[model samples]
Target: MEFSLILKKINNTLSAEKELIFNDWYSQSETHRQYFKGVLEQFENNRITVDNKKGWERIDQEIRKKNSTKSYWKYAVAAAIVIAVFSLPFTFKNTPSDLPPTTTLEQQATIEIGSDKATLTLEDGSSVVLQKGEHYEAGHIKSNGEQLLYDSTKTTPNVDIAYNILTIPRGGQFFISLSDGTNVWLNSDSKLRYPVAFAENQTRMVELVYGEAYFEVSPSTKHNGSHFTVTTLNQEIDVIGTEFNIKAYKEDPIISTTLVEGKVVVKSSQTFKKLIPGQQSKLDSKTNSIEISKVDVSNEVSWKNGFFSFKNKQLEEIILVLSRWYDVDFKVQNTEAVKIPFNGVFNKKQEIENILKIIENTNEVKFEIKGKTILVE
Candidate 1:
């Protein structure tokens, strides 16, 4: 019933408690629904034709709520922005998850935001810790804290190509610019093995040893028509020049490859399917079968933009993602609770406790924190 809650719901930032409150108010009566409809219509039109100027003022105040992210004012120039809180799709107007909820460790057992950090294993088997605000250089490869950049301008004279492995720890993330100018964004608990300098006039290859990564591959035309291929356990993605995301986490049963731009062919032992933009190919590792489906590309790649976007995701699956991001463990005391579907969006800048508290307010479940482990019931 509160206008503030409605606004939060509109932006997909509704707290769990306020979500229930808004859902109740939304479903309570047709008049309430009409008022909500009128609010959105006003947002679309940028004016209020109705005489309820006082109510409209209250709505305006909610839109200007301090620290707001996706206020109606953001979509002032455009209309048709609707909140997909329950069934409608909340359009980003633009614009995944390790289940990252950034927080400080001062008062609790210590949880910090997954930062720009990774362990780089050089060709000599030596290792270097790459984190924000640090620098490292080897041969033609260099890292400037936030990203690892390879100098393609230099030529590799080594008879054997030198490979570098990057491993991202939990509560961390990193980016890499491959020797061929292919860009990769690695998620937490992910590893990528690539060459320091891609060989010329040959197929460019890399392995997603594990975890998730988003790739903006450099065009083959830049490399004299060298096709790029990404290899996983039982899958291979072939692309000439395309942008895509691959999720091959060991904990997850399915290996998902979501094509954002360009084209990719996802091949398994069973069959191969070519993916177009906005399409996702999910391979069942156990069955070795792949299923292609249309997906919301924004939801699949939202983590690249620093937000956790869930579209009717089960709590159990969501918990797994969060555990990896926060470097914590979670146990659900109530089996039934694991299947509960939830919808909302969260920024990684929030504290884990705050996020847990927000979800706890839903009353469908409660949380017990023991050290860094979370028990849900």
Candidate 2:
């Protein structure tokens, strides 16, 4: 682990690959863990913490504060002292409105962080619950609780395509390596349907079923020029050796397909839009139309990188993501607060209360945790 990783994690700019390296270092020693915590304190203390309620205004304040350069300098000096001492590295969806606005519910609750978990439904409709430390296998498909993998080389010819569905529950996530070498990172409250193996000399296909996923597709050139495609409720993505993210949660009114690298063509009933890196195509569920726009790809797919990025995200959006991962519900008593925006990057492993505290610190929004339900005032 390098010193720069500490900076990246604190800044919420750490990538998925670097995160693994940081984690390995973090688990090695208690000294490393203490150093990590110290670094976090320095960084968080110096930076002007910001969140949704105030939207981009808070972001502007943070930017202006950074431009002053004094806080960052202090943080850097503190971290440098840590390096001189010890080394360390660091790393929603909708909601329902089922609460009565007149009632105020506040109770202490312990919301644990989610881990790798999912329900796999085989072609025969038999379901298997996958959780951390558990193992399951069928034919060439194997899952080690953390990830599911399929061995394409062991596939049999002339057999009908056996379909399997993987459903991710709230407060959980899972990874899968498909038969074609395509890698998929599934977020909380998502589901995907795919074949056990693809037929030779044909297109490989899968469906989002619902929720969010980041796909790293195996190029067609590697498979005799066979194509790969992903179908969601709103649009279909034609891929040619690319990495992309799709957000199509059941409660979300808009379906977003963000291309991180390479190429992808998003098709809808109206027309098809080809997207390049740093571009996102949003399909409105009500209109059945696709709109293309430039976006910060890093922020767009930050969740896959083990960070919940709230740049330009509204309170409603942030809450949806938080609710899904924390397995809790948030009731916004101040309805208009739902549109409030926040700007910050948080580690998913951080406690739900820490985040609630941050938002509450703004004084613009107040959150009362009542068991699994939070009353947002």
Q: Identify the leading candidate in terms of lDDT.
A: 2
Clash totals for all candidate models: 4, 7
Give the alpha-carbon lDDT of every model.
0.74, 0.75
The per-prediction CA RMSD against the true structure, in angstroms, equals 13.1, 10.1
Cα TM-score per model: 0.73, 0.76
- Kindly give the stretch of ten consecutive residues in candidate 2 with the minimal lDDT sum: 91-100
The residue-by-residue lDDT of candidate 1 on 107-145, one tens digit each, is 475767667899999888999999999999876778888
Model 1 lDDT, full chain set: 0.74
In model 1, what is the error at residue 22, expressed in angstroms?
32
Candidate 2 regions off by >4 Å?
A: 1-107, 156-159
Clashing pairs in 2: 51-342, 52-341, 52-342, 92-320, 92-321, 93-320, 93-321
